[model samples]
Target: MDALPIAPYIPQHVKELLNVSIKLIRFQYIDYSGILRCRVLTASFCLEQDQNVKFVGTGPAALYASYVEGTDTTPVAAACRLVPDWSSFRVCTYAARHASVMCRIYETLNSFGFRRCPRTCLYKVLEIAEKELRCTFLGGYEIEVVFMDVTKSPPTPFKNVVEWSLMEGLRGRPIEILEQIAESLEAANISVQQLHTEGSQGLFEITTGPLRLMEATDALVYTHETIKTICDKHGLVATCFPKPSAAKGLVGQHLHLSISSLENDPIEARTVDAYIAGILSHLRAICAFTLPSHDSYTRVQDRRGTNGTWVTWGTEFRDVPLRKIESTHWEIRCMDGTANVYLAVAALIAAGIDGIRSGRKLSWGDSQKSPSLMTDSAREELGIKTRLPLSLKEALGAIKTDLTLSSTMSQSLVEKYIKIKTEEAESLEKMSPEERTELGIKYF
Candidate 1:
């Protein structure tokens, strides 16, 4: 186990406490399908080893290609190594007798970074942002999940009232589940800024405080796992599926972002404007990563207020795709729970960096009316030229043609991502809507 560069920042007292308290260490990573996977080793194993690196088969990466369903010829079919990032080390509050940490994947013999690794991809983009743009990105995710009654034949929403932030909605099991989730997240050092019921029955949202790019996304992954684990222990099913049903409203994983200089000052207006312009310019292509599933498109429709269909932005308008919260921050609404948070954030950073470099200007003004409600002539007058891609196939096609976004991601990763998602889209085309929803809940 190779020690992380963050070891220097760990206080000696905290280090000693961890060394004494932890019995097992879990090295976790998110797969291409956005599922959290882990490999566990005894604490003594890490303490005894000079370098904390652990070797594991790369079969997990092949999971996106359905390697388990059939044969896998992907590069990830070989052996690889997990290099622990000590900065991400967290004491597991949900599970006793173990601690968890995230790892960067590297090829065993060649010592090359795995191209398809989401964490590494994010780090590369962040590095470019800091080095070239001279800025630091801070972000947090607003996670929305539904609690289901598993005892029913088909799981149903746990609450009957379909109200937003209503106390009546949280009267029973929902409140207890949410309280436990908040406690568990706080215990793991992941702060929950707010937790409340959403518009959909049994749907709740958790808002977390901001952190640097990598830490924010990594914390979200841990947060989701904690919610699901605790919910299961209480005999309820917690799902972040974007649209659990057509009758119910949509659920989203909205990303809130802000940028600041190395000196910790808020970015200038010109720089901030260009950064947003860049994102809006490449949003359709970026959607290939942020909204990865066929069902994801189902949630990103017009008039939903959850996510808009057009590529426009506004000041605190929920109907627009990008809602400007403050001079320094904006909320990206197109993303859903199914997205791989690391890849999604990386794509946004890549787009923003390009925008900054190119000095892009905002081509359109803010619109208070939802694009879906606006007349064609109104949209034309505002310079809103295109609507967002309506399907997974269309979104993938947009990425294929997007030179700017394609250049930002590694060619190998983009190719593999398209291949895996294309296959998924094709497969979904043959399934019934109910079948598709069931499968999405199981994996996403």
Candidate 2:
């Protein structure tokens, strides 16, 4: 029962996790202020849920257990179930508990009458997508986040950031952080395709192997927790916000996705193109969730695509809503680390599936490098309309227009998220940027 403070878990389940791994307590969610965050689990974090459970987030319903004896004081990391050839996972979690329990929960749920997709927004999005396209959708996702040397003895507003240097950005000893991240990701079965430094200061990315809907969601949460811990140990802060800092805060999580059929064939050309169209059509609305923060709009642009401009395909057009990485796959650029990963990715999946089902027109354009690379007149003429919402409230209103999308985004969750965000925006409005700056992660 969800009682005051979630009570202590049933002794049996706690014992089971402890027996398997006792060196650690369960995974708890804490925000930048070191407050225990909430974990919203649709079901229990029972070990048996391995086959039945789908994914977990910071609501506090589930956590990993490890038996390393005296490792209580040690820092822990998160690992995903990535396949091989991506990153080595063992050294990755020198401090992490075994993820076997997580898989067990998933496997057990499947054995029972549970759907591979859980009863959550991400699942609903996947479900709607499959139903619409009348086909299966495989998910291949990757995101980027930035880290800084912010101390936590007592947190402070993040005013300092390392400007990304193409020459020395990740070229120095700092690159070791990327190596550790890759190893930890691999340990959890998550694979890393590559790691890179971004154009912004201290911005970095860790690409992961492809996974289905639920599993992909799990990986995203785990990645954040893992990296955050590591960053903390280094006396730094890892921020996934659309833009954590205004001086040079263009932080975003670019999602690279690939969809396939029940059969092995991929959604190429026509369907894929149409899928892009559907995504673009629904993009402004989707940003209501992706750019969920009041400051989220500040991080978007078409020039570099930070302004959340057009939904056009271009060559590394960071500002474009959707940039074609190749003929088979493309990455959406507007999403930020601050947006709920599950909500944003699920919106994309649903919107694209809608595109496929609607048999909409597929629109493609020159993949420019950044917003500056493309002229406004040319972008408009190409039918690549600009629809990035400037504020969180504006984006939420845009998302509200799509009744069908509301189906994908649970009204309950949206209500809570929007209510909190609206207050935040108003609060930020009351304070000068400097005042808001002193309080770290006000939106997050």
| Highest lDDT model number | 1
lDDT string for model 2 (1-444, tens) is 011111222245544544565334333231211122332222234333334432332211121221111212233332222111111112226354432222211212112211111224566667666655555554545566666555542333233234543546776544777787778778767778877766666777677777775666567666776778776677667766554555454666667676666556665578777877888788878886677655567766645535345556665555567767776567777776656566677677777777777788966567555544557776665666665677777776777677655555555445544554555556556666545444434324
The lDDT of model 2 is 0.55
What tens-digit string does per-residue lDDT give for candidate 1 at 1-444? 222232223335435655798788788887666667778877666654423433544544433544123224446435565666667888889988777878776654443356666777888888888887898988888999988786875667775577888888888877888899999998887879998888887889999999887888889988988988899899888888877765566878999998888765767899988999899999898999898887888777777787678889888899878998898889999998888778888889889888999999988788888977888899888768778888989999988888777678666677767888787778777778877767766665
Candidate 2's TM-score: 0.71
